[model samples]
Target: MMRLSVATLSGLPGDIDRPRYDRAGIGTGVVHLGIGAFHRAHQAVFFEHALNAGDLRWGVTGASLRSPAVHEALAPQDGLYSVVTRDGAAERVQVVGAVRDVLVAPRDPAALVARLAARDTHIVTLTVTEKGYASSAADSAAGYLAAALAERRSTGVDPFTAISCDNLSDNGGRLKQAVLAAARQSDPALADWIEHQVAFPSSMVDRIVPATDEDDIARLAGRIGVEDRAMVKTEPFRQWVIEDRFSGPRPDLAAAGVQLTADVAPWEEAKLRLLNGSHSAIAYLGGLAGIDFVHEVIALPAARAFVAALMDETAATLTPPPGLDVPAYRAALLARFANPALQHRTRQIAMDGSQKLPQRLLAPIIARLDRGLAAPALTLAVAAWMAWTGGRNDLGAAHAVEDPLASVVADALGKATAPEDRVAALLSLSQIFPVRLAGDQSFRQALIDDLALLQEQGARAAFARFTGR
Candidate 1:
């Protein structure tokens, strides 16, 4: 058992027997906002592999706005961590050394502003999740962008690019609005500068990086023969699509399986609607049925059929983006969701239901309804969400609901005359559902009916009825 610095452990995987590349030479070029399991397993791993294969100047500097755990764990070891990739056959272990530093969000607003103003910091990326943005535009309010813009206006330092790795539609544009709005509040001149200098690039990031469990840590230690404070496990598949908007020198990530293009809207829409939407369906429905793991739900016959049907409906409405094959892409997504080794828990995916429902479920429902197609399955999923949010599941386990309006939601559910009214009240929150969707009578009733069914028949029977199988 050797005690190695995080930096040293990062270089160990490649240096086990034969050296891959000059691990010590990699430099940090990107700053990531959320240092969560997904980023560690997906983006960090990509950068690590690229660095080992002779690419440099693309190391990641992980940061967080609230969590001190990431900073505390990685800072002691020099911003390095281990990633374990698991599938059915074999587990590939790697140490990622590409993270050069980790920063906590500025406790002092001025200092946080100054950090972003740094000239050498080329790309500012975020995995702060959907809710982290505090977005309000059919999404969160983009609070981070507002803060950054306010800081930039006062400081006169320019950021190169604002990359959003969250699962949102037009994430870059959404973030830009928040930043520009914040800038406009203080100084119009700063808003102009941001409009001209800052590049808010949209991206589609995918990976099923589950939270680290004890067995995962033990396996990492056993395989690598070292102590890794920060270890993340994920499924084998990973994809990153970015709009090529950079204010400074950027990495040639295109050489490492990343797609760079002028427009990432179509790709973003496809991923959000297909993969993420399917995930939301499984998470809410499965969690309500007392299923704990995502793979376990997908393994069930009825749940798998429901998911496949949803994907089929989604695929019908969406054409694949350029350079993508729809059928193959979907087949792969289904396979990824079914990976038993990953054991992605339903509750983990179920978090942030209020923020996630719009993008992952409601948006697709709107799209389908616009085309005059039935989105009954999606509606049922929404019903399950309302049930789950009411703070009780089939097992009587209290759901650790995390929405900002949790108390309001709980109180509303308590006083509502029936399931339909509960659905209506939740939708009317405006903070969760948009005014347009909230006003749709047909949509509201569909949700009510499905929720009533869920309460009466239970999740399994309700799902069986919806699928008619």
Candidate 2:
């Protein structure tokens, strides 16, 4: 079977959409990091729209910080890949040509730095997940930006706009700090210049791109009559919200259905609290109840209602962006979660609880407290997470808590056998909890009560009480 490339595109089904622009005339103006499935399905597709709109300078070159698999697969096919948008009943297949090249940073760090330093590369985007920014090694995203920005500074070149498309509060601000720290490790003067020149824009990217396995590969091959190694599967619904800040010229992404806003803070808060907070609820509670996938969790009446109630609790804390219908957004999130075709694993979202919970749950909990309200559902979600870290399900099957702080969590858990003691021990971890909140009697008691209910009655009973089932 012919691999998906510029050459095999001519033989695709007439209904299938291929790039309308000439690939040969396109230049790489955007350098992307963490070229995972999310980047391919979301930002790369948006850039394809920019290219199709006749702006040939926005073609992308994706660089992987560590993984060579993406580079190996895409580079062999002229950096071409396919994105299939599933809407439950049917699929929309399209070949994305926005990515003109691929690079592996570890293979040749100089190559990636050179690409970032290129004159026409006015933009740099990333989908390296939340934990990617926390890595301090020189091979990480922050390290690469520090290196490239230093080179650009030395050579009298303008710095590129660095956009973080990860889900976190003040995502841009966090990335800027990380890059600055990395730069200061070697050159403080260079870090100072980068602080004033570069623009680290926060962006909220919404799309469900599941990890494509061989089954997906074969299914897409049957549809497109080609064997593409880098095919990404996503839902028809896609959204990108970017902060309106840039060091140089950027593509007309607003025309590509992107929301370029002056303040991404409100939008980020809404997503983190509502959508992501509910997701964590489903993952911990559902994963503990012996559920495997997200749709399966939503299919359970108790689980579904619990998730909705959790979102409702968090929604009370957000001041959403204008024109965003809160009720409708919550409904859409539930609908998206219930899509069975996507095969989104609950365990996948359950990873990095220590890293994720502060943004997703704790923020809203604090907000609700300030409003003189209780976060019953959100507090229970945290309890479910504590139970999940015990590494076994209600069915007595082994469950893995895939977190960087797993051993620390275990040590905390091991410090006590009683529910209240366990709650107190975990709360004392300065990494996940703030000093004020961790020491508060009301908050600690709430966690103790919730944890007692879950550990004693199991997942169903606790969920039943939350849902009034």
Candidate 3:
């Protein structure tokens, strides 16, 4: 019956796991973009642990770029929320007080710029997904970041680290490129200063944080005896591998189970290719099969073997990170994907197929082609995406496909329904497929065969054909 807030922290039940430090005493040192479920479950929880260990300066000021929804949800609660980590029947509930305030960018862009320029704000992190990095400086997160950094420069304040927790290869470099490119449009001088001064550190973050629904909120409220509309339910496993590069002081994140390294490429590539690649395969193929959840897909014998083969093909293309056991790491990932309590939906991952395929699936396919090897599993995954993108599932049910390139996909489908024609039409999309892959006869033939098989045999049978099981 009670609402969660800093004032109510002390009045909660004695058994409730609430903030150890005084919420009012903590200062905001990090400004995080995209106040979504993933950030709440992963990064904010880590900051809560650091705060619990007596670090008061690492509190986060959450910012949302598009709407006022997150700001509206958390402001009344003083940025208080519950994070429940679920692994099968076991669960741990904790109230996180790491976020002190929430800022909606459109409502007050100047406030966000001021927060970024603040002297105490040493880290500006983002989980805005890949599409947030717009190519132009006119309307993007990079544009806003550029404007804020320009303000800091004009005021003679130092630059902070720009950490990207997005799942992209060489994401730090990409962030730097986006930021510098945007800054160049306004002031070449400011761009130069940011390039020379600020640190754009790439990071690899892994956590299965599902989109919370009314059921999740009600379940948390029932357990904690307080209403927490901003609750996040996630899997127990978490990993954060960050490049050890920063312009200003940062919290000892290593104490919170973060891996600080000189090079984050291997880790980033591994997670992208191994975890993300197979995830896409499961999403597209499983959705085509009318499977609702990732755990259900991974539980299938054919699906499990298909994912393993996909990972094996991708692994051949990667150089493992130092001290990492590739085999053991992969086995652990399979176990994590099979966690039914996480309830990671296939439809959730199936969205944004056009934007995601380039990095997650296509890159590994390109690598295999370069090595003069046939990546049938990867090709089948690509075919599955093409079929799914046609705007209907195997059950003939029409679901909303939420890709930025929805028009492009529709155009591709309109051109032809024949296997070869459809495969050619989709492959010619230079945005998603590389020029070399598009031109390769063998790759094109392989994709056409797989696509035809998917159409004729259905998703499960096509998957069994690829796995030869």
Candidate 4:
């Protein structure tokens, strides 16, 4: 075994074509809050490409709020890593050098805060997932942003742009509200400062970065002939849409094919409602059918029809974003999800249902219902969720569901005393659904009916009934 530096590991023959750039000579200009796989495969790769071309003031400092394993692994190598993109026939490995440091939140909050408040740190980006936003119990991003903004105010620092890569509508505005609330909690003056100084940029990020397994590690090592600790693998396709809202200096991401626009609302809505919504549909419905992987679900006739139908329903409610070809976009999404090489797991997608359901299922359901249309596919997905979380699958596999509201959901399901009561208790959850949605008698009944079908029949059979196949 050869001792390898991060730079050496990244420059192998089959990997990134060049040696890692001398990043120590440049200043750290970006602090990425969540150093997850998607961020590494998508944003970090983009930043690395930009830096390779010319821009040096856009290096990233990886920060994790909870996980210390990443920090420990990358720190030994001076924050250098590799990204491997895989489709069915080809694999490309690139050494990403943009991250200059890795910071664990609790280990050194003071240091993290100092870096955030630093004058040279022009951008603070997050891929902290929807749950990390510390949004209220009622599904809002305002709470987390408020806390971060309060830290900024108490420290009296120059403002940097906060970019959210989470899949949400008006992600930037939601973050701003949270920051302001936190500032207001600290002092009225702090909130006033935030209103004047801060900028929150909404973004839509798309990439199917699956969890790495032993086979992936071996494949990467054999290809590159080096042990790259930070290697991540994902589906070949990727997309990022961002609002051009920045108060300070930022990278020229446009050079790397990133779309920068005045408003990201339309793009966000399209991606969230179509791509993410369909993903949830497949995950829940597929998981309950005993399918283990996303590709497997896509291969199933019922699962495929469910996703396609859901997308069709979603498309009816959404107008294409400016300059986007709706049919072409939908075609690409279908192709991406059906890529067998990705092997994204159902259990992985199935996590955080409480945080995901409202945006991915309920919103579209409500929108369709408002239009006097029935969203049967969406309703079935919701029913699958309730059934999936009700503790046992058809295989009798026990589910240790994860969510802040898991206990409550479990308790409510337990009291199922009856199907109607179960649906009522679940829907009436103000934390997961708006009052208007909870109070909808028709919607409640639909949920009750679908849930009953899911309980009586299996997932595949229930899906068939919902789709009338």
Return whichever of 1 and 4 wins on TM-score: 4
lDDT of 1 by residue, 138-257 (tens): 112244555555565466656657888899989998778776776676567877888887889899998888898888777777766676678888877889999988867776678778
Model 1, residue 400: distance off in Å is 1.3
What are the RMSDs of all candidates, in order? 3.3, 1.6, 1.3, 2.9
Q: Could you tell me the lDDT of residue 431 within candidate 1? A: 69
Q: Could you tell me the lDDT of residue 295 within candidate 1?
A: 84
lDDT of 3 by residue, 113-167 (tens): 8898898888998988888775645447898789889888898888889999888
lDDT of each: 0.75, 0.89, 0.88, 0.77
Return the lDDT, model 2, position 159. 90
The alpha-carbon deviation from the true structure for residue 204 of candidate 4, after best TM-score superposition, in angstroms, is 1.1
Pairs that collide, model 3: none
lDDT for each residue of candidate 2 in 316-344, tens digit (9 for 90 to 100) = 88888997899999999999998888888
Q: Comparing 1 and 2 by TM-score, which wins?
A: 2
Candidate 1 RMSD to the correct structure:
3.3
Q: Which one wins on lDDT?
A: 2
Candidate 4 displacement at residue 120 in angstroms:
0.8
Candidate 2: residue 389 Cα off by (Å): 1.0
The TM-score ranking, best first, is: 3, 2, 4, 1
